[model samples]
Target: MIASRTHGGGRITVDQRADGSGEALQAIIGDVGDLSVQAAVGDFDLATLLTQVPAPLTALNLDACRMRFHRQLAASLLELETTAVGVKAAAFAYRQAEKGISEAFGGLLDAIGYATGRIIAISLPVIIPVAITIGVQVLVVSKILDVTGLDDVITTHFGIDLGKTKEQAKEALVTAVFEHSDVAGAVIEHVLPGIVVGFVGLPPALLDTDADHAYWPHDSQSMTVWLLAGANQFGLLLPSDVEVWEAEGVTPPHEKPPRDLEDLYLREAACHRGTDSGQVRIEEIVGPDGTTRYIVYVPATTDWSAKSGDNTTDMTTNVQGMAGNDTVMREMVRQAIADAGIDPNDEVMLVGYSQGGITAGSLAADPAFLADVNVTALMTVGSPISDFAIGSDIDVLSIEHEQDLVPDLDGNENPAADNWSTITVDYDPDELRKAPALRDKSDAEIADLFDSAGAAHSSTAYAASIALLLRSGNGSLDRFTAKNSGFFTGDLKKTRDYQGRRKHT
Candidate 1:
């Protein structure tokens, strides 16, 4: 006989007899919540209930509709909230990493390119000969053996004598090939190709990628700036120990004639009398846009001996000498800019010739000037400033003649530290000398000689070249030229007042 037992705890029970006969009973009771089910069956009895029911029991309660099927639902909700916060944090980290990577990679590429370019430039010229030598040796040995018939001779003459010495004879034949006359010719022929290959192939292989990316617009601009400096006489050789200009009483005139047309005519007339008389003063020129421009002058040389006890001539000469002192001139320009209450980083243009050109170039290259002023363009004529280094950030244009030895300087290196983007304008000195008829036979007479000479050496030619450089949009130097003529014209007009004032009085 089979007996069945039913328990009311969200489960069913069954009992089987030995004959395999069994009865199944479903347990169902009213109002038995989760606690009643636990009470009806001990907590340890859940395993039996699960086995008997063969169904997942998340919660055993009367209100089965409200019971959750799995705990993962709640866990997933918590994870979703956490993931939102995590994503924001990750995005921020990624941005920082991206910036860091870009900078690192950019720096690395620049260094590798620079080093590789230098190595190729230096080593390519050296490796060609060595490669040729090796190739020549190989070819020469082959050709010598063919021409001298040394292999056959050695095999026939020494193989039998040595008895089992065919290998030795072959070695002898190979050695004899090097001694043949034809070997030299063959070596030369073979080495030529190797030499060509090494000369042409190695550098390309080493620096092809670097060369493509190594150049920049800034490089040209920088070189021009340095070249302009070098072309000007601004290249000052400072003593290791020096005194500041202020301490030395090295200052410009307090009052002077404006460097305008009337002043120029007056100074020019003074030159007729062989009287070295001129005055240059700085003044503020206001533009239509309300921007103020500083205008300085290149005064005619004057005799300072007539001055009173103050020795105004000496002071003028001293000021002229200061044009060669790059450090002093730079400081003065910086002070002038500061005194004008203008930001040094604002756009600045320098136009000067001869001594004035030297002053401008030196001031542009001064680190302090750079820190304070944003030099947009520099134009110098017959200036010897290109001897100095200019910053890569500035634009510098220079006009020089082949005969103008003043523009030429020593130890000019590539990737110039000062004027990296320097462009030199070459002109015919002979042609320049013929442009304007010579009136007087003095050193100053040569000034007009340049007008016809087409010579880069003359001040007139330099001035014309500067005008051309400023007008032409081509070349890195043009980038620094004034964008508008209004400021320049206004400043030029304002300079007339300081043209011919007597500094000695």
Candidate 2:
């Protein structure tokens, strides 16, 4: 017998028998054993996976979210297992062919069998592992999505480009990928793992943001929304409900609505001062055609203590504010309208920032609330109100920042419609400081201007951006502000404040 060394780290002794065929058979067996071991490793690797990808919602008791994360991890492991099976099957097929051919040709086939074994030994092991890795990546994200069932993960869709240039590029890329499905499929197979893990890098709360699915395409902010969130915070900390008494009517029905969005932004900013006392100033405007506009302002999150008893049910948590029934928010709004002595049939236009924006949207969308007061238009900044299904007739205006991330927490923007519109701001501290309102502030002060969602979510920053937008002649903004211009250019109107308390049942 001759001893032959194989790649499997074992030596196989073959009978010489004056035939070279045993050399090939020994080589083939070694390759087969090594392949088998590789397949085994793949099978066992499932247990070793670090399956702790965090969820979008940042709460300790979110069992549902944790389960979904586990499901994705499990699905990935199963894909790995399938790859292992394919490797094992390939090994089995090679071994069987070698056995049958050897039996048929006797020792004469040894040279041919050995050459075949060399090719298999050299090629398949390298090929199989690479192919499996590619396969796992290709299937992992989709597999996770498949098991996601209609749980409210605040998941975002891959479509929708808020930029004209990016939208054009996206169209071209999407068309090409879909046109060549095979190539696109192959590319996706390699990159899907990277896509899934990228969003898991930073939790939004650290930067005072909510979780967003895609950081680049989906996440953004708005100062208007932050201000509203700030208002909510104020209300919670005061532990009081909010009340809004209508502004006194303009003299000749043309004196209000501010000279420009900057004027409007300042007027809105001024509302922030009164939030500490839990009273917000609101404007009730009457137009030439008998249209009425009720301007409402909301602030940020406050009252984060155990004073509220349950975080999930409290108005202080964004999750509760957006997801749960609007007990505190709706009550404050309802009382505001009622205290202002506005009739149920009067048209209401709601505007707010952050949590305040959310509360406004919730009020606009809630049928019960609408039945009592007609919500005609809504304008929000930095608010995640996408889940609120407001009426189509209501004029909706939203502003967001690409890097803000808070607006993305609701998973999507409202569907495109003529009455619905958006303004997206990409905030810059230098640009913001240059604004007249912030010009006098030092760089450090400018840097520290906005707290929650960075400079983009800053009220002063948004005020500057709005001033710029107004100057740019954006049609939607022009129309919204121009129609309400009576507040700034026309007559004297009376503004009032109302007090509110939470209805703790």
Candidate 3:
């Protein structure tokens, strides 16, 4: 059996119970009850039949048979309904047990996180002094070696040189300390939560200070919330006017709708290749029912530069997106959707990976966007979007890998709602090795590559995991597939590409 937990629709099911089963079972029970009620009141029109027969004894016998049949049918229907209730009750108990265990695990993690943050806060005074002492020791050691000419001697004789100059020596010492210290690694690992804890501990008065009262770029919001919030509040993280235009020389449209999740992911992956290939893919699908629907594919961050430039899908946008702030990436996509001529009444599905996923969630959560488009479904892979309060009417499927730390950046678990489901699979490095970028490498090289964090976040690995889920006969995934069948069965009406760049101020 697949190891998975589904929470939503007011029920929790571990690996044993399939998602949507309780709702389906309850519907059946309701139908059974309705049939039992109908059977109890139903008649065979026997009085009319007797009038035509013109034999009192025969007619009375026929009426008696009808009454018996009606009694038996009603009794049988009631028995069936009772059995369904029992089955439903048993399933509910099992599901509740699973939900309890899952919550326990989540609670444990929450406790640990809070404990760690509190400990760090309480120990900062001691930690700072200890760090200062270590730094002094490193400075003294460097000075001694430099003053005695031992640094040059070691460099010449043993090919061991820490640094030539005093400044370089200090820098080298600090670098060595960080490289060899697990403490440094731990600090980096917990930075996201640490910042949140720090923010949470601030006084209400401090947090309430108006950001507008401060100087531009040094507002109270930035100062109180730290760098990410500050950058956005100060306008440094704001996107330039996104100039979106129709992409030219883009690849031809597919003949049919995406066949599976992997195919959709691959399409999302394509958006990251380069801006010339187009940053967004909008497909107008003519569904089998003659209604038109749209699928918008958004890509991960293409640029990691500190400064926001032409491409709104950059590191700046990543920060803005994760902070749940308005971003140029989102604006570009929104504009593209409008340019595609998708009406407010048209059904739309959004697919995104990484930053794209965050953008998609933001769009789905935005009231303004909802007013402009009928977003029916959203799928996000390797995105930290738990904080987005998307509407329950939208069917949401968030796919994540346990080892991919990106989704954890939000510092919150995805909401457990009936309409929203998160599928988290354990990482397999073998899947990473099959990535196109790694396929041509040697075995040794591939082994080394597995150590990279990016390996776990690979779109290819995500796609491979999705393939396993599709084949795993998991009930939750099947239900999702059935509900969104419109997106997968349609013919590709047309494909449009749009690119945006931040306007230079």
**Whose TM-score is greatest here?**
3
lDDT of 3: 0.70
Clashing pairs in 3: 8-417, 8-418, 9-417, 9-418, 222-230, 310-501
Order by lDDT, highest first: 3, 2, 1
TM-score of candidate 2 versus the correct structure, residues matched by position: 0.47
- Candidate 2, 141-224: lDDT as tens digits: 546645784222423354433244446776566545433433332222222212222333322223222333223211222322
Q: How many residue-pair clashes does candidate 2 contain?
A: 39
What lDDT does each candidate get? 0.40, 0.53, 0.70
Q: Which candidate is the best by lDDT?
A: 3
- Residue 386 local lDDT, model 3: 74
Error of 2 at 105 (Å): 54
Candidate 2 regions exceeding 4 Å error are 1-256, 273-277, 288-293, 306-317, 450-453, 483-492, 503-505
**Model 1 lDDT at residue 441:** 42
**For model 3, how does the per-residue alpha-carbon lDDT over 403-483 read when each residue is reduced to its tens digit?**
666776654568878888888776666665554455687988766655454565767668667776676665657666679
lDDT score of model 1?
A: 0.40
* Clashes per candidate (backbone, < 3 Å): 62, 39, 6
Deviation from truth (RMSD, Å), model 1:
29.8
